[model samples]
Target: MDTLELQAKAKELRQEIIKMITAAGSGHPGGSLSAADILTVLYFDKMNLRPEEPDWTGRDYFVLSKGHAAPAQYAALALRGYFPVEELNGLRKLHSRLQGHPVSSKVPGIDVSTGSLGQGVSVACGLAKGLKIDKLPNHVYTMLGDGECQEGQVWEALMFAAHYQLDNLTVIIDHNRLQIDGQVEKVMNIEPLDKKLDAFGFNVLLVNGHDIEAIQNAIDKAKTCQGRPTAIIANTIKGRGVSFMENQAGWHGTAPKPEEAEQALQELA
Candidate 1:
């Protein structure tokens, strides 16, 4: 898809995210909205995926390391034809495959079950190493929240990726600068992130998370990088595309009410 088309698809994903979260009565919307463009570009334009064959080994893998943003991934999966779009309304409901987080066994397109924060990237590192062992050309990609960077395990995973020279791996950080409590800096500063990643041996690229052209270019650059993993620091807004919610940390885990959802959907439309 071209830039306009990708932006439109991202709007659709954000709308679905608001709808599903409101229907479920509780789920993360801020982070989900922030990551919509990144997910849209990945699933719709970059990744080698088979919606009809989710288990296809030849396809590239994506892990939503920031699992609370499952609504965004679910929206992307449904729109990409991995499952019925109607299933999106079942998000976080009882017995729904579309839970609050990406579950590999339950969800068709999810390659890993993620929720505990900082662990999904470790699994992604394993997948990259395994692909390397098999001599496969497939690549592995994962997204992490900037707040989640405070976890010690995340650093360990990055160290592992660098040691193995997993160039097939691309890690995108949704640098929205907010968490549930407040600004990420106030809660726990993770400044100098790009420098840290570079010190860990990653080919780091910084971009505006909402800009499709920049995101596409960064991902393409990651693919060409050799001998080390590439990390894209995607600077974004917490609740992007919605007027009232944009940049508000309070929306991190709060579902929009019906009226709020209406306004957000209309804005997205």
Candidate 2:
């Protein structure tokens, strides 16, 4: 998709995210809105996904390491035709497949269950290594929160990926600065993130998370990089898109009120 198209899709996805979160009365809107552009580029322009055949073994894999941002992924999946967009209304409802966090078993396009944070990246590592062993071309992509990088296991997984030279695994960090508690740096500093990843042998690419062109270009570069895993550190706002929500940490896990949701939809419109 072109720049304008991606921008339009992102707007729609943000709208969908706010709508679902408001309906559910709970969700991680901040990160979900922040990741809209990256997911839009991946699903619409980059990833080779078989929406009609969600179980296709040869399809590329995507794991949301920051599972709280499932709303953004669900919106993209629905828009990509993996499931009915109407199902978005069922988000967080009783017995709904669209739980607060993504459950791979229930969701058609989800590759792994990821609620414990750092573990999902490890799962991506295993997928990449397994595909390499089997000589398959499918790549593994995972998104992690900047705060989640505080987990010691994240580094462990990166070490394993680098040691094995799993270039097929691309890790995208949503460097949104804030977590559920507060600013990531204040809570648990993960600065010099590029240097850290580089030391761990990752081909690090830093991009403006909201820039579809830059994000897509980074993903393209990641695909061709050899002998090292790639990490795209996407600098982004905690709450993106809506005026009142943008950059506000309070929005991290708070659903918009009915009035707030309406205002957000108008702003997107």
Candidate 3:
């Protein structure tokens, strides 16, 4: 897909995220909105996937390490034709496959089920290593929240990935700077993030998280980055594309009321 199409799709996904949280009366919309462009580029352009054959062995794997952003991934899946878009309305419903956090078995396209802060990156490392052991050329991608980086497990996984020289693995950090508590740096400083990641043996690349073309290009480079894992630090606004929500920590986990959702949709429109 071209940049224009990806941009349009990202807007739609942002609106859909608002709808999902509103319908469910609860969710993490800030991160979901922030992650729309990254997921759009992954599903619409970069990843080799089969929407119909969700379990195809040859497909590249994606793990949403920041699982609170599942709404964004769900929107990408539904829009990419992995499932009916109407299913989005069922999000967080008692029996719906679209729960507050993604369930890999319930969702056809979800490879790694994650809601815990740092576990999914480790899972991605394992998946990448396993694929390499089996001589598969496919890659594994994982997205982590900047706040999620505070977890000790994340650093451990990075260290392990580097030790094994897992070049097929790519980690993208949603550096939106806001967490559920407050500002990430104020909550816990992880500054000089690039240097920290590099020390962990990752080939780090920084990009505008909202730039779909840049994201696609970063993935291309990650695919060819040999002997080390890649980390794309994506700088973004916390509640991107929504007028009242952008960079607001209050929206980090609050579902909008219907009127608020309407306003958000109008702004996104």
Candidate 4:
């Protein structure tokens, strides 16, 4: 897709995310909105995915480590034809496949069930290792929140990925600088993150998470990297598209009111 088309798709996805969250009444809008651009670029532009065959072995895999932002992934998957776009409205409903967090067994496009912050990276590493063992050339992409890094298991996974020289594994950090509590620095500082990942033997790239061109370039560079896993530190806002929610920690886990949702949608429009 061209840059213009991708950006247009991203805008539509962001709007869909707002609609889904608004209908659900309780979902993580801030993080979802923040990561929309990245997810759009991945599913629509960067990754080679087959919606008809969700378990297609030759396709690239994506694991949203910050699974609270499943709405973002759902928007991308729906746009890519993984499931009916109308199912988005059923988000967080009881017995709905579109749960607050993605469940791989229930959701056709989900590669792994992820909601427990730090575990997704480990799962991604396992997928990468399994592919390596099977001599598969498919790449694994995982995205984690800056706050999720507080979990020590993430670092352990990082070490394992680097040690194994999992060049096909790419990790993206949604460095939005805010979590449910407050600022990431105040909650559990993981700054100097690039330096730390580099020291851990990763080919680290820092870029604006919302920039389509930059994200595509980073993904391309990651694929060619040798001897280590690549980490893209995506500096982003907490609630990127909506005016009231941007950089506001209060919206981290809170759903917007009806009026707020309407305004949010209008802003995106």
Candidate 5:
């Protein structure tokens, strides 16, 4: 997809996120919305994927370390043809594959089942290392929430990724600056994040998370860096693309009412 098409797809993803969350009457819409463009760029433009062959060994992998944003990943997967888009409405429902958090066995595109903070990156690092051992060209990408950086395990995973020098691994941090409780800074600051990532031996690239071209460029650049993993600090707005929800902490895990959903859809349109 071209830049315009990618942007359009991102809007569609955001619309689907709001619809799914509203229908399910529960979800982390704020983070999902914030990460829409990042997911769009990866699943639609960057990753080596086979929607019909989810288990293809040669394919690249993506892990939503911040798994509460499963709606964003779900929208991307459906649009990418991993499953029927209609299945999205069953999000968070009993017996549904599209649960609140992604499950690897149940979901078609997801490789790592996540929800426990700070674990998915470790899994992603493992995948990268395994691919290296197998002499595979495939890459591994994982998205982490800014708030999730507060966890000690995240740093441990970073250290591991660095020590192993998993150059094929790309860590995309959705730095939306807000979590469920409040602003990430007020709750627990992870400031100078880029510098910290640099200190951890990552090839760090910072970009506006909403800019498709910039995001694609950063991912491409990560592919060229040798001997260390890459970390893309995507500065984004929580609840992006919706007027009332943008940057609002309250919307982090709150489903929108019907009227609010309508308004959000209109805004996205």
Candidate 6:
């Protein structure tokens, strides 16, 4: 897809996220919105996915490590025809396939069950290693939040990926600089993140998370990288695309009030 098309689609996806969360009455909108652009590029432009055949062996894979943002992933999957868009209304409802976090068994396109942060990258690395061993050309892409990096398991996964030279694995970090509690800098300063990843033997590419062109270029570069895993540090804004919610840490896990949702939707329109 072209840059303009990707941007428009991302905007639409952001609106869909807001609408779904509003209908459901609760969700992690802030993170979801922050990661929408990266997901847009993956689903609409980069990844070679088969929506109808979610388990297609030759297809590329995506793992949402920060699973609370599943709403955004769900939006992408539904819009891409993995399931009927109507099912999005069932998000987080009793007995709904769309749980608070993604469940691989229930969701057709989900590659892994995620929600507990810091584990998705490990799973992605494993998948990449397996594919390499099988001689498959497919790639594995995983998204992580900056706050999730505070977990020791994430670093362990990074070390493993680097040690294995998982070139087919591309890790995207949604560095919105905010977490559930407060600003990431104040909560746990993970600054110089690019340097840290580089020291761990990763080919790091820093870019504006919301820029489609930059994201596409970075993914392309990662694909050609050799002897190391690639990490794209995507600088983003919490609650992106919504005026009142933008950069507000309080919105990290809170659903907008009825009036607020209405206003937010109006602004999106």
TM-score of each: 0.99, 0.99, 0.99, 0.99, 0.99, 0.98
Off by over 4 Å in 3: none
Which scores greater on lDDT, model 1 or model 3? 1
- Scored against the true structure, residue 93 in model 4 reaches a CA lDDT of 97
Model 2 regions more than 4 Å off: none
Better of 3 and 6 by lDDT: 3
Task: Tell me the tens digit of each residue's lDDT in model 3 across 1-269.
Answer: 68999999999899889998899999999999999999999999989999999999999999999999999999999999999999999999999999888898889999888998999999999999999899899989999999999999999999999999999999999999999889999999999899999888999999999988889899999999999999999999999998899999999999999999999999999
User: Which 10 residues in a row give candidate 3 its minimum summed lDDT?
Assistant: 99-108
Worst-scoring 10-residue span by lDDT in model 5: 179-188
lDDT of 2: 0.94
Model 2 compared with the native: what TM-score?
A: 0.99
lDDT of 4 by residue, 1-269 (tens): 89989999989998998899889998998898889889988999888889999988889999999999999999999989999999999999998999889999999889899999999999999999999999899999999999999999999999999999999999999999998889999988887899999999999999999999999999999999987899999999989999999999999988888999999999999
Q: Which residue pairs does candidate 4 place in steric collision?
A: none
What are the RMSD figures for all models against the true structure?
Answer: 0.6, 0.7, 0.7, 0.7, 0.6, 0.8
User: How many steric overlaps are in each model, in order?
Assistant: 0, 0, 0, 0, 0, 0
Q: How much does candidate 5 score in TM-score?
A: 0.99
Give the C-alpha miss distance for residue 226 in model 4, angstroms: 1.2
The window of 10 residues in a row where model 4 has the poorest summed lDDT is 40-49
Error of 4 at 218 (Å): 0.3
TM-score for model 1? 0.99
Which candidate do you rate higher for lDDT, 1 or 6?
A: 1
Off by over 4 Å in 6: none
Better of 3 and 5 by lDDT: 5
Give the alpha-carbon lDDT of every model.
0.95, 0.94, 0.94, 0.93, 0.96, 0.93
lDDT of 5 at 49: 95
